[model samples]
Target: MSKDNFLKGAAILSIAGFLVKILGAVYRIPLANMIGDTGIGYYQTAYPIYTLMFALSTAGIPVAIAKLVSEKNSIGDYRGAQRVFRISFIGLLIGGVLTSSFVFFGAKFIVGKLENTNAYYALIALAPALLFTPIMSAFRGYFQGRQDMTPTAISQVIEQIARVGIGLALVAVLLNLDKGLPMAAGGASFGASAGGFFGSLVIIYIYMKRRKKIRKQIRRSEKFEKEDTSKIIRNILIIAIPITIGASVVPLFGAIDVAIVMRRLQDIGYTQKEASGLYGQLTGMAQTLINFPQVFSVAIGASLVPAISTAFARKNFSEIKKTATSGIRVTLLIGLPAAMGLFILAEPIIKLLYFSNPLEVQESAGSILKVLSFSVIFLTLVQSLTAILQGMGKAFIPVRNLIIGALAKVVIVYVLTGIPGIGVKGAAISTIIAYVIASFLNLRAVRKYAKIRFNLMDIFLKPVLSVAIMSIVVAITYNIFEGFIGLKLATVVSIGFGGISYLFALLLTSTITSKDFELLPGGTKLSNKLKKIGLLRR
Candidate 1:
């Protein structure tokens, strides 16, 4: 695929990602109110286990298959590519089934074993989504590797829509049926399984439709070469397994934290209920809020994997370096200002969105949000760098970094949670500290081991400047809107204005140049489309 194709893919995926994230946040705000922090805690508490297993089963394989398939196809090796796809899909299908069973049937034991019992039923609801998520992801990787963003992007939106729509409806219905808040929240979270089922079906339809098109292309051409199916499977697994393991560590740390930190909190002085509420705030509220900006980072990072892998496979070191630098730069460009905005506006944001809920621990939610905000920059950087290293095929380095971070987190949480004043703040501190360690380790490894170096100035300065401008604009807009609009509406409007103004300022200042725009997925096509639609200045 050409650079233009990359840009087009990025643009579509980025927009889809933005929509999904926005819808996700909007859905969560009410859902948080519906479930309260305690319910959210229960919901999130079970999620890490689900997330890790999901990652182990399918995370690395899809990208590996996509990279391998794309590379093989580029070299006109259709037989090898076809074999790789089939094997990876079957492996994921099996893994998905086992995970779903383990999560669903074992929910009672898992919840009973947990320090917090409030989250047990939520785990039950979430199990099916765990089963189907990998299957959907596999198809996404297949299409993405083929350099088609339409299906992948569309499916993400459809999944979120299904999730938000079904989740809200179900939660309301369950609440009315006199289910407790936590149980209702669990019901909401469980809707992900339904969404996953539907989303996977949508992608399957796309794949079936495209499969015929590809077959026709193959029949008309004689350029394709076949390979042994077993060899292809082995090669795909070799590349995919390490990546899957590495990709899962950060989330695994999070899941382990729910078990470890919640238990520690109870051991120190808190009641089971209080501890559950606190854990919920940290994971469900603060972490979820922090995740909003991460959507951009993740979407960009996901696109970068294939982009960098393609470049590296062809030995275009400079292009690989450029993509790496751009990916990190773009992450910070979006993340820093978001972190700052959250830090400054944490209380209002949290209160405005979640305060109406009757959850027991709402008063202290602001502190939770603030503590988590500090980790966003580090988390975003770590995420982007992890993807870059993986793309360079130095996937083990990220795993090592995560191991170090996880070890640090365990030690820090143990000491800090026992202290007189810290309590759940210890977990937040551990997360930030771990992310710092992981981010630096990842960057260093990429430089030392991969012989990859990003331009420091390009990565840091332009993005920082862009964020500064955005922050200033946001602050001004928030103040201007405060008197006219109610608190929540004012907050929302100010944020909307801030985002638009920031992008505008970035373009005006040339922080993100025309070339940068052109290099983005569908930059030229989007620009032209915008111009045609009169959204861009002539």
Candidate 2:
């Protein structure tokens, strides 16, 4: 894909990701309030296993397939590309079944090891999604590799819809029936299974409908080279394994948190319920908000994989530079404001979302969120640069950096959480530091390999200035509106003003240029209109 098409693909995925995250926030906030932190603690404890499994089963191989398929398409080897998909799909299928079975059957043992036996049912409920998730991911990788993000995007949104609806329904029903927290959490967990099943069906149908067209392209290919399945598997694994390990680092930290944080909190003299509540506040509430911006990072990172891969395969150095730069720019443009916004409005935002909870719970969660907000920029940087490196066939560099960061997190959380009153807040601090180290290392890696010097004025200064301007408006807007309107409405309106002002600042300072706009779908026309309206420069 060309640079413009790359942006368009990112746009499609970002929109879908945005929807998914919103739904996720919708799901988690209600679930947290409904179950309270202790119930959410059980859910969150069980969740890390699903996330880690997800990273293992779905993350790496699909990216590997996308890169490989993009490479194959560059050389007009359509047959080899399809073979890569098939082989990878079958392997993922077997792995998913085995992995999900392990989780389902081993739910008690797994939750016991994590020290949250309350999550046993939740673990069992989520295990089935592992089977379906890999299937959905296989098709998603196939489509993404071919540079068609539509199917992946559409499927994700549809799946999230199902997940939210069913998850909420099950949780509500289970809770209403006076079933135990474990069962309620399990009901919520099963929503993922339902969503995955539906999502798999959607993507599979899309593939079937497009199979004829795919074959038509295959037959018209300038070259058809059939590779041995063994070789294709090797190529896919070579690319996938490191990526999977790297992707699992963050989720692995979840397991780490489950293992370390609860024990540390209890050792520091908090009651079991209090510790669970604090854990829930940290993971279920703070982490849920942090994940909102991560969706965009993930969307951009996904697009970058194929963009850089296709460009690298064709030896198009300039395209690589352009794509990498855009990734960085977009990362900054979005990341800066997201992190800043969260920092500025942490308490209000949390209170607005979790108003059903006691004031102390809301306050505690907001404080944790404030600390976690800065991690957004660092995590986005790590994600963006990691994608660049992975696209350049240096996937392991990121995995190494992230692992190093994860280790540091373990030491930091252990020490910090051991302190009286530090507890889960310390866990939040550990997360930020881990991302900072990982992102710094990633940036260094990108510099050493790609030699793409980021222009400070374009990428850093512009975003910083835009966010500085935005921060002023947001702080003022929230403060001014809070007294006049109610708290939630004020928070919402301030957020609305923040978005408007941030865009205005971008346009006003020309931080987002006509060239940048041209990279987006219909961006040229939008640019022309902006120029006509005196909001854009030549």
Candidate 3:
């Protein structure tokens, strides 16, 4: 694929990821309003466990499949690619079934470890998704490996639509039935399973539609050497296991939080209800908002793996360097502004999005969000660099780095959160510190493997400058407007102004060049338009 084609694929996934996150926000804000913090606690309690399991089951396989297939296809080993997919599919199916069975049967045992006994039903409700999502992920990985992101992007939107619509509807129905918070949350959890079911159906239909072409290609590849099944499975595991471990780090920390945070809060003398409420605010509210900007990073990371893998397979060092650098630069360009914006506008954003909550709850969430805002830059870096490492076939490096980070997080959480005044905000602080550690380690690994020289001026300094200018403008605009206009309207206006100001600063400083624009999806057209209007140089 052309460079532009790679970017276009990333763009499609990024846009879809953003839309999925928006739908998630819509689903979550309303659910938080309806169920309140304790219910959110119950719901969130089930999710981390589910995510950890899902990560083990599906996370690495798609990436491993994508990388393996891309490498095979790069060398014209079509038979090898098809064999990889077939073996991977069967393995994932068996693994998914096993994990789902464990989660379903061990629901009570799992919740017993955590403070939230009410989460048992939610755990059971989430079990079926574990079975379905891995199958969907296998298809997604196969297509992504082929450098076709359309199927994965379409499946994502379909999944999120199902999740939001069905989850909310179930919550409403359960509420009307006069079910308590735990049962209502359980109903919402069931919607997650429903969404996975629908998502699998969508991917299955797409696969069926394309089966004829796939079979034709496989038949044509019969002349190529065929690998043994055992070898293929071993290769898949070799690639998948490290990626799975790396991807599981964040969710593993989340699972740790589910176990530690509430119990610690109760130990600090808070009532069980109060402890759950605080945990709910930390995970359900603050973390939800924090995840929005990460959609872009996740998209870039996903796209980077296959793109870099192809280049690596071809032994194209320049392409690998260019792809990795561009990915990191784009991550900073998006992440810096997002972190700054969230830090500056935390309260206003919380009030705007979660207005249904009481004022004090909104205020508390806002404080937690402000502390969490610092994580955006580090998290984005970790993600982008991890992808680069994985693409370079150094998959185990990120796993090691993340383990160190997770250990740091555990210590920090134990010490800081144990204090009476710190409480939930300490968790946010520990998260930032953990990502900072992981990002640095990943950066060192990338520098060593990719041999990329630092270009601080272009990558880091310029974006930071532009973001600083934008933050100042936003703060001033908001301060002036807040005195006369309502908070919401002022927030909207200031955010608009800030975005425009940031763009202008980036252009005037040449922090972002026309060449940069040309690398993005539809960027060539945008560059041409800007040049025609005398906004961008020739």
TM-score of each: 0.82, 0.86, 0.88
TM-score of 1: 0.82
TM-score of 2: 0.86
Per-residue lDDT over 414-514 for candidate 1, one digit per residue giving the tens place of the 0 to 100 score: 88877758888898899999999999998887677446766656677767777777778777877888889876787888788778877776655555643
Native-to-model Cα distance after best TM-score fit, residue 238 in candidate 2, in Å: 2.6
Clashing pairs for predicted structure model 3, backbone only: none
Best by TM-score: 3
Task: Give me the runs in candidate 2 sitting further than 4 Å from their true place.
Answer: 1-18, 63-89, 139-154, 203-232, 302-326, 452-458, 518-522
Judging by lDDT, tell me the better candidate of 1 and 2: 2
Q: Compared with the true structure, what per-residue lDDT tens digits does model 2 show for residues 150-257?
A: 999999998999999999899999999999777888888899999999999999999999999999878877666567888888888888887678778878989889
RMSD of each: 4.8, 3.9, 3.4
Instruction: Show the lowest summed lDDT stretch of 10 residues, model 3.
Output: 513-522
